[model samples]
Structures are given as C-alpha cells and as structure tokens.
Target: MVREKNPNVLSVHSIIHRQALTAKTLPTKLTTQVFNLLAYLLDICYSLNLLNLNLQDGGSNTIYHRDAITTYTYKFQLWNRKIIACNYSCFPKLFGMLEEALIKQTDTTNKISNQLQHLTDEIKRYFPSLCYNDSYRLAMDPFTLTQMFYRKHCKTIAVIKTKYRSKFNIASGLRSALSSTQPRIENLCKNVQAHPSH
Candidate 1:
C-alpha cells in the first residue's frame, strides 16, 4: 500500500535487527567463560591497584569483546574504552593481542579454548568473515570509516557549493539526464513486464 502510494520509494531493512539477533542468541556458556576471564582480570586489577578500571560499573555483566572497535556490554553499551585508546588502524590487532594474553594465562585448558571457539563462531555469525571471495564489506575499521566519512563530507561540501553557485544548473542537469534515460528505462520496464521471467 505504501509502495502503491509512492511508487518510487525504496525499502531497506534496518541493520539493528542483525545486532539484536546477535545479542539475543549469545551463548550462555561462552558468557560464563568471559565472566570468569573478567573476574580473573578484576582480581589482577585489585592486586595491581588499578582502581580506575571500571569493568564493574553497573550494567550487563556479559562482556562483548570481539575487537577494540566492537567491544561492548550485553546491554549494548560501549565497553573497554581503555583498550580502544590505541592508534586507530591498530583496532584490528587489539583483539588478537587480547586473545594471546588470554591464552598465555590459561595453560592449554579446554575451557578457554571452547570459550574462544564459541566467541569466534558468534563473531562469524554476526560480522562479515575476513575470507577471500567474500563481498560483504563492513565499515568496522576505524581508519576506513574515517576515510569514508571524509569522502562523503567532501562530496557534501561540493554539492552545497554547486547549489549556491547555480541552483538551476543542478535541477536542469538532473532533468536532462532523466529525460535522456527515460526511453531506456521504459524499454527495460516493458521487457520485464512482457517476459515476467526477465
């Protein structure tokens, strides 16, 4: 009905549903292992007198540590701020270091390995895998995200400058472009309608 009223309207599903699903289906056993790790870290924090560590702040106990750029609590609040304070491009390397630390602490224990495996599985389920021949690129890298932001910012600035310089030119250009493509679009539409399978 909405599409009938606005035939040109485009519909795209929100990405939040994926996030919600990822959060909802988090494995409890993995969470427990993470809690154990956090507890161990908390004990170390106490011993090292790192009173500024706020891991115990009031919120979900579930620690969602995938990478520095993607760490959060189960309530979806950003967690591990200190861990993300490194250079922006180093964000991808932070999780590897953390995993190494975890491994060093646990001496070939199946519990830690199982937890890490579950975490890996959950990450693969939620995020785009870093595999070749994969096409689903995500804007998760800080450096890449910054570059994209600046690129769009520059484009927006250019559009604004052009609009201020000559308002009619933009509309007239679009009109001409649309007029030039109208016949091709109509022909494509006709072909699709006639074939139904095309």
Candidate 2:
C-alpha cells in the first residue's frame, strides 16, 4: 500500500498560535494536557448528548439545578486537570471516567422501549457472532432499529416528492384501436347465416 505524502505540506501548527508570547514561562506540557482533556470531554458529551440530558432532567433550571452543568462540566475539567497536573500521565484514568459516565447515562430511564424492540431483536439475533465493541457500533447506528424510535420534532417542514407525472401518449392508444383485426365475414356469427347463394 502506498501512502501519499503531499510535497507542499508544511510544519505542524498545533502549538503555533494558541499560546501567548509569554509562552517561554508557560508550561507547554500543561497546555497540551488541558487541550487533550477538553477534546476528550467534548467527545464524550457529543456522543452521549449530555447537554440534552442536563436540560431535560436534573431538576428544573433553578439556580442550584442550573449549576448541574457546572457539576457535569467539571467532570471533564477534572479529567483534564488530573492529566495536566500529572504531566500527561493516566489516559486509562480518562477512559475510565468517560466509560463510567457512559454507563451511568445508559442506566438513566430516558430510553423509549417500544420504539426499539425491533432493534433489540436484531441485536439478540446477532449476539452469537458479535464481538466486544460491536454492540456499541450496532446500537449507535443512525439506521438501526433503535434509532427509528427516537425522532426530533420541527415546526414547519417541506417535503419534496421526487417522482414526476408521466406525459400521456394519446397517439399510442389511437394506433392500437386502428390496428385491431376485424373478424372475417364468414367467421362472424352474425354474418355466418348460411349465405343463401352458397
């Protein structure tokens, strides 16, 4: 297999402009660690819909309840902070944290079951051959049985029907009528009265 490397590719700019001019005093490792934590936390929240969860449950948006965002958001911050303080040690720690969050989210009673029975059946059928991570892959597929159950509502929607009306062919119907064979005179029952001359 050939790997394509662009000749015009330039130097890596990951650390280029995000840091300040005082960066010589900045802890470069800490900055990278914080960035990693932010990335990971964003990934987990995205995949699990944490924002939606917080808004729906965790009490009405009172001052205390609204701060639940801070609580949940802090978990990600904690994950990042730990890594930074340890100087980029303990990725397993981060994975464990996200995994626990995922597990907890699954335990929440937010699932609509009747909508997902078909998906559950499919999963059961595939259980014999499935491997470890395949369950997550199958469960999260947009087209899977489970996803059909959950729907987002919208106020005004336009649906376009893509099929066009067929143009009628008046000439073909007339041609078929014109080409039909007439019954032979002798074979026509009405005309078959023994020809008196015959």
Candidate 3:
C-alpha cells in the first residue's frame, strides 16, 4: 500500500533474515547425523547471530552493511575450503564432537562442505552487488579523496600562515575587520580648530 501510494518508494528485505531462512533447508539426513547435527547447527547459528548483531548495529550506513556482507561471504568461502581439506578448526564444536564420538570426519565433512558451498552460492545469487568492485571502490574513495585534498592544500595553508606571521600588528588588522563601531570623522574635524597662520 505504501508503494502504491508512492511509486518511487523502494522496499528492501533484511539480508540476514534471508540467510537464516535459506539455512532452514538443510537435509533431514544431514540433520540426523552426528548427534542430530547439534554441534554443526550450533556453530552455524552462533555465526549467524554474530552476523545479525553486526548488521543490526550498522544502522543507516550502507557501506558498513556492505562490508559486513562481504566479510561474511569471504568467511563462508574460507570455511568451505577448510572443510573440504578436513580441517574443522573453524567449527570447534563439530571438531570436538567428532573427536569425542570417534566418528570418522569423512562422514559429515562432505555434507557440511556441500552446504557451505550452497549457502555461498545462494548469497551470490541474492546479492549480486558483492560481485562488483566498482561499488566498493566508490564507497572507499571518500577517505582517499579527503587525504589527497588536504595534501594538495598544504602549501597554500603554509603560505597563509607565513603571511599572517609577517604582519606587524595582527590584532589591529583583526580589530579593523571585526569592529562594529563607525568612526566619528565629522566630530573629530569640528574639534580641530583652524591653524592660527591660516
């Protein structure tokens, strides 16, 4: 209805919410393995919770939101690679569970790796902005530009400082520039009597 009233208004869905929903589609078999996959789910849920907090705290800064998303996407890729290589360090709970239960890492590693890949794929599919470098470059340019601007004006600032320092009576110049009272030229002239020889 809001959009109907104002056609130019844009609507957006929460990216974290979308990710949480996508995570719900994990296979029943995958969920059933390794003590109902509690350890795995707990790790994923904890990460997501942290991500949600980051996104929530980002407030109205789209740059911060983009950064958070980009960081999370990179982490997903890293986790996928680590899982494929049989390294479960990133998911400490899952690693501990496997070690304690004498479970072969091969059994669940493939499933988890596949799910991570799927999640990464889904994120790319949904957030195409992450694929473009131009947006990030533009977002980052302001700080760079500000530094460049200050560097370019440094000589001018130095010249101004030197000119100000060379002045003999800076306070008088400032008083002339800032004073509000007008000079009483006529009164001063009237007070001066004509010269006796004139």
Candidate 4:
C-alpha cells in the first residue's frame, strides 16, 4: 500500500526468479549450449515435481527421500551456475568452476567455449579490480584488490601524464588525489604492502 502511495517506490524480486522468467522468453535463436542448459533446467524441475508427487503417494520414507532430493537439487543448482551460497568475493572462483564444467562439456574450439570466454570478459569488464588477478583469493575482502588496482591504475595514469605534461591536467589532478588515498589503502591492506609489486 505504501508502495502504491509513492511513485518512486519499486518492488525488487529475487534474481533467480527474474532469470527464470527471462530464460523462458529468450529468442529461439539462442546458441546450442544455452538451449541445452535451459532444457536441462526444465528437466530438473520436472524431476523435482515427480519426486514431490512420489513422496505424497507414500512410496518411501519421507526423510530419506527428502535428503536425496536435496542432494540432487544442490547438484542441479551448481550445474546451472545458480548457487545460493555464492557472494561477491567468491564469484570469480565460482565462475572458474563453471568454466571448468563447460570445458568438460565441450571442446576448446567450439561456440560454447567462445560464449564462456565472452561471459568471463563481460564479468571482468564490470569488476576489473577484483577479477584481474585470479590468484588473489586468500580472503573474502574484495576491497583489498579494489584498493591495490586503484593505486596501480593511478600510477599508470600519472606516468602517462608525465609524457604529455602540458596537455594532461586531468591525470595530474587524479594523481594528486590518489597520492593522498594510497597511504590509507596501504594501511588497510598490509598484506598487499608486503607484496606491493604484485
């Protein structure tokens, strides 16, 4: 009711639900892997429904059947790249696992591999600071990578500024701001300071 009263208010729904709706309405010209993946998800839903029906018919013990169903559901979720437990810090690792699974399902010189690479590139484009260094997953602090890369990019811009000092007021200005921010970032990530060259 409050949302109705306020035009600016909007309803936010679960991402999984949104994805499911979009998947259903995807154009028929989708690639082979995407088509198969959607079909596989539909099959999983059907199997789950069958499990529920069988349980209701008293075909077996409720606890054991439910446990088996839960296990299968988890496997399906992982297979579908829709893990509920995944968070921002763990996203790169999850993508790596999904890519590995995709690799197993198709050859390197296939459309599926190209699609996977495109998906990875898109993710990296959005989160370059976090996804740039795949080997830096020690802890779940995304800020560490963010600050480290921010400092690095600042230095890079500063170097470019030095090459064209007369026409580079913006880069010079950014370098000055970064100079003040770097120390605080260094203090926040002593581990990065220990291996700053990385």
Candidate 5:
C-alpha cells in the first residue's frame, strides 16, 4: 500500500532479520543450541557496539582508533580462551541464559569454541598493522620514543628534541603570521615623505 502511494519508494530488509528468519527452520532438538548461540552472539554484538561507540567519539584521531582496535583484538583472544575453558564471566547475558535454561557448560563451550577461535584469527588477520608494536608506541606516546632514543644515543635524543621544538616554533609562527593587527599607516606615510621623490 505504501509502495502504491509512492512508486519511487525503496524497500529494504535487514540482514539480521533475514538471519533470524533462516534460524527458525532448524530442528526442534537444536532449539536449546540455537538459543545458546544467539545469546553468545548477542553478547559479542554488544561488545562490538561499545567499541564502535568508542571510535565514534569526534575528538579521537587515528592513534586512538588504532589503540582501540588493538585492545579489541586482544579482547577477542581473551574471549576465545575463556570460551574454550567454559568460563562465561565476560558474557553475562549468555551465562544468565545458560543458567536459566539449565544448560551444561560443556555443551556451550563445545559449540562456541571453534567459532570463537576462528573469530580471533580473523581479527588478527584483518589488522596486520597491529603487529608493529614500535609504531603504535611512538604514535600513542612520544615519550616512549624519546626514552628509546636516549637509551640508544644521547645525540639522537637531542636531535629528536630539536625536531619537536622546531615543529612547535613553526606552528606558533604560523599563528602569529595569520593574526589580525592594524598596520602602521602613519609611520608608513612619514617614511614615504622622508624618502626623496624619484
């Protein structure tokens, strides 16, 4: 009816909604397994949403985003280990659902362990840059580089300090160059008068 009223209107279905519809076709014997899987997935989704929100903060730059991604990658590893060990402390909703349903820890762990490991692997694969500990450390904390330089050679530290000081001086110089100020028109006129006319 809405399409009839507006011929140009677009209709779209969510991928998640489609997945839910597909899940309903599973056998009745697997109902508990299905619910357990859904609960575990929902917990993961919540955790991912928190990371998304953290990245969405307007003031954060690439360094912070990389830090967040690195942290989330580590979390995936931790979650994989916990799930393999049948420890549900990180997944409160999944734990509660399993408790309420009287489901065995072994069942949930067996079901989720491979999938969680695959997810952890995928995360590490997707973010190859996270392997460079030195770059992340330098970007997140300049002092780390300074300390390393100081340890390596005192001259290197002095050079780095000079470079940083020059950067600040350039920024301040640009600011003063752009600042609005009244020109000395009278002094200019007097100087023009004092000069011999050609």
Candidate 6:
C-alpha cells in the first residue's frame, strides 16, 4: 500500500513516461481542426475551375468556400490551443505542436495542389496565390518543425533553384496542351505505369 501510494517510487525513464502520459491526456488537435479545412478549400477550388477571362467586370468568383474556413478558425481559436501545459517549462512544447500544425497543413496543401489536375478532371493552376495564407503562417517558425519534416521524409529536401527558370507561356500553352493531349493519355494508358502519358 505504501509503495502504491508513494510518489517517489519512479523508474529511470520517468520523464519519457510522464511526457507520453501528458501528450495522451491532452490531444493533438492538428488535423481535424486545421489541415482538414485546407484540404476542403483546395477541393472546392478545383471543382469550381475559375477562369481569369470568364469575369467581364474585372470581378472574380471564389472556388473556395469561406464559411467553412471561418467556422474552423473559430473552432481552433476556441479549442486548438493547448489546454494542459502541465508544467512551467512546457509552453515551448505547446508552441511546438502549433508550429507543427501550421507547417504540416501547408505541406498537405501543396500535395493537394500537385494533384489538382487529376482531381475532378480539372485544370491545374500552379498559382502562388493559392497557398499564400498557409505559406505566411508556416514561414514564421518555432524551429523544431524542420526536424519534424526531416523525420517525415527521412532525408533533407534538396531545393536547387535554377538561375533562369522557364517562364510558363500560358496564353496558348497549358489549355491547348491539355485539350489536345491529356485525354489520349488518360484513355490509352491502361496496362501502363506512367501518368500524363503519350
């Protein structure tokens, strides 16, 4: 009874055990709260397929649904922040989780963007503006997120930028290319492994 009641009877790995306990006690509110909204926004945008020239009044319609974004943001504000810091020094850990959430959300957005052309058979617009808000959130860092990404990839990302990048000739380029060739590739590529085929 004394051994069971005593607080001092701890093993050598007490810190690790305590952290795991705390993490499980509190929840990781990253995906359901934040990243899922980003994914749904990307999906709606792909489905809408807004064209620049389609708007005659210099006004544009959004592919993204705003109410969902607002609702999720409200929920995050209401509950996403860590409820149990557990210790005086655990604030950094709480911040680290937030930073993880923001960074991972941006990564998920990029993956969805990369797959946009295939989704709902829509045109893929590699617009910088598409992911601007997410980029802004992730660019400001709490530092350990780089380590997290490295762990995810199991290697460092090698970004070797070229001095002279090829400018996209969009006017008679991607639309024409897609219209002319993309269908053939989709149709004839059965029993084949490569995509964007032919």
Count of clashes, each model: 0, 0, 0, 0, 0, 0
Residue pair clashes in candidate 3: none
TM-score of 3: 0.52
lDDT string for model 3 (18-126, tens) is: 8878868987456547452578889988998998888888354777777788888899999999988878889988888777766565767888988888888888887
Instruction: Give lDDT tens digits, candidate 6, residues 3-56.
Output: 689967755658888888776755445433344545445434542443222433
What C-alpha lDDT, on a 0 to 100 scale, does residue 134 get in candidate 2?
42
**Colliding residue pairs in candidate 6:** none
How does each model score on lDDT? 0.44, 0.42, 0.76, 0.51, 0.77, 0.39
Over 4 Å off in model 5, which ranges?
1-29, 105-107, 131-135, 154-198
lDDT of 4 by residue, 60-117 (tens): 6634554455455444444334323321112343344445455333321243334434
The Cα error of candidate 2 at residue 72, in Å, is 3.2
- The TM-score that candidate 2 achieves is 0.21
Error (Å) of candidate 1 at residue 115 is: 1.7
**lDDT of residue 184 for candidate 1:** 67
Best by lDDT: 5
Output the TM-score of candidate 5. 0.59
TM-scores of all predicted structures:
0.24, 0.21, 0.52, 0.22, 0.59, 0.17
lDDT, candidate 5, 109-136, per-residue tens: 8768777777767867887767477777
Please list the residue runs of candidate 4 whose C-alpha ends up more than 4 Å from where it truly belongs after superposition. Answer: 1-34, 77-198
User: Tens-digit lDDT track for model 1 on 35-142?
Assistant: 555654453345234322334445423222223213322212212222233211122333444454453323223443444445445655675433322121232345
